[model samples]
Target: MSEAAEKFETAMPAWKQWQEAPWGRLRYAIAEANPLRHFGERADEPLRVLDLAGGDDGDALRLAVRGHHVTIADYAPAMLTAAAGCVAAAGLTDLVSCVEADANALPADIVRGEFDVVLCHNLLQYVE
Candidate 1:
């Protein structure tokens, strides 16, 4: 594993605990918000969405609830596990799927993947 990823795994427990807390959740709040604000006219039509580093934030699952098929690509396996659990709990197995991906060196799951909407809320400054 890469040094950064390995370090993140070591800090997984604390990260998860914080992320599960209400305050942390508020940082990525979208589940209960107006989906229309983000989608505008496309809100009604079902669109394929690619959520990079989406993890277990519940954002992808919420999009699936809106009838859009969502693929959540996260670098961390544990995060994907949590996201899978949430997806299954929401009975959105068909609408939501997970893939392991690292933006630094993306795999076909992300490189060749096709989608109508791509959500990457995290600040990603492209060096190139």
Candidate 2:
């Protein structure tokens, strides 16, 4: 296994702790990790965005809602499931897609040079 994978395995899994957190708490902690401000006044402009290690708090949901294509990628299945649920509840299933991916080594499927923006919200801390 890669050293990054090993570090992830040895560390207390962030996804697990996130699962136990109140929805509001996690949402506030990592609120919109930069997508909004980065867009400046181009809120109406749609772009393909990849949210690396995106938790289940809908941090990037705002982007997805505003007609931007968002892929919420994470290492945790549970978080992805919750994220799917949130997107579904918001009727954004068509706008947002959730997938399981490791930040250290992403799959070729996700690595295709197709995205216009990439947001790694709260992912660096877990990456080595």
Candidate 3:
């Protein structure tokens, strides 16, 4: 893993806690509207989305709830575990999936061009 990824992996526990807090939920609620606004005309269609460095997959769950297929990818395995739990809790197993991967070097199976939308919120600052 890259240095940034390792650092994030170490911080996953704290991250998970904060993500369940009010502010985190608020942040996701605010950001969730973007995809719908942008894809307003295609509301009936199921869009494929990728949430890069999407720890805990809160945002992915939101998108999935909107009827989109979402993949939450993070370098931290713990984050993916938490994300999986969120997916299950939301009962969105058919719409959301998790992948452990480095954002700097994502696996070929998750090419950017394959997704209709790519959510990269709050991830760039950690990239190196």
Candidate 4:
């Protein structure tokens, strides 16, 4: 892992806690509406989405609900665990995949252009 990846991993626990708070919920609600705003009506299609640094993956879940195939990637194991739980709870296991990966060094499959849309939000602020 890189220095930045290590810092993020160390902060994951605190970040996970905040993401369960009311303010975090509000942010998630707003993020969930973003794809529709950008993709318009076609957001509901079975498109492939790569959600990089997708902590807890709430936005990805929203996309999965719309029948999109989503891969939610984060460097934090705890975040990926939470995201996996959310995916299971939403009954979107088939539509969503949770991965522990750094955005700077993405997995080979992802580098192969497996995704139609890359959703990278609120992550660069933490990177050097």
Candidate 5:
């Protein structure tokens, strides 16, 4: 596996634990950093958004709840699984998709601009 993938695998447990915490500073940080508002008030149309390094924390799921079609991509399978569960729990299965792919090497289809918004949050630190 690539170094980035290895690091993500190593960090998955801590990430999960961090996300499990009750409404904390991290939650506020995520809300503050969220890009959804930038999409503006005319966000009725389901926007195709890509979330790189998106853990199982439900940030993308929150966007989906707001009527966005979201793709949650992560290098770690465990993270992707967690994201999927988050989507399911939110009853947003139709609005969210999960992919196990490294951020550095996104699928060709995505590189071709399949999404309207691409998020690379908290991922650059792990990239080689």
Candidate 6:
């Protein structure tokens, strides 16, 4: 595998495990930084939001609950799987989409400007 792909593979287990924690769930439910504030007055619109490195905690789901269409993107398949369950449980399946994708090289399926709100929380620290 390429270096980036290998890194993602290695990171999957730890990411999955972390998502099982209470703190993880809490953090996702209440993101440290409020996205609504950053979106400014435009928050009223039907926003397309991207939560990069969203893991399985469902921060994207929370955003969706607030009337945004959110995409939960993560490099780990396990994370995506768990996120799917979370989305379903929250009845957010219609508003949230979980995608298996790296933060560094986001998939082409995620179009540029496709998202009005892009969250990179806790992701940049790992990338560099």
- Structural similarity to truth (TM-score) of each candidate: 0.78, 0.72, 0.85, 0.83, 0.79, 0.74
- The regions of model 5 sitting more than 4 angstroms off are 1-3, 22-29
Cα lDDT tens digits, model 3, 21-83, are: 999788888888776788878866899988998887878887888799988889877678878
| Backbone clash count, each prediction separately | 0, 0, 0, 0, 0, 0
lDDT of each: 0.74, 0.72, 0.83, 0.83, 0.74, 0.75
- The C-alpha local distance difference test score for the whole of candidate 3 amounts to 0.83
Question: Residue-wise lDDT of candidate 5 within 7-66, one digit each (tens)?
Answer: 667887776666677754577357635675677764667889888877664568667877
> Model 1, 15-122: lDDT tens per residue?
778868997688656543644477888888989888877766467877888799988877777778888888888899999889877765668657777888777755
How does candidate 3 fare on TM-score? 0.85
Write candidate 4's Cα lDDT for 1-128 as tens digits: 65665666688778777878999888888887776688876765799999999887868988898899999888877678878998999899999998888888888877886777888787888677
Worst 10 residues of 3 by lDDT: 1-10
Clashing pairs in 3: none
lDDT value for model 2: 0.72
Model 6 TM-score (2 dp)? 0.74
Q: How many clashes show up in model 4?
A: 0
Ranking by TM-score: 3, 4, 5, 1, 6, 2
Off by over 4 Å in 4: 1-13
Over 7-126, each residue of candidate 6 has an lDDT whose tens digit, in order, gives 756787776566668876676656734777677887777798888888764577667777788888887776677788988998888998888787777778885646777888778777
**Top of the candidates by TM-score:** 3
lDDT of 4 at 114: 70
Q: Candidate 2, residues 1-128: lDDT per residue as tens digits? A: 45543454454357457545897456644555456677777767888888888766356577777789888887766667778888989998888988777876788989985998888767777755
C-alpha-based local distance difference test score of model 4: 0.83
Q: TM-score: which is higher, 1 or 2? A: 1
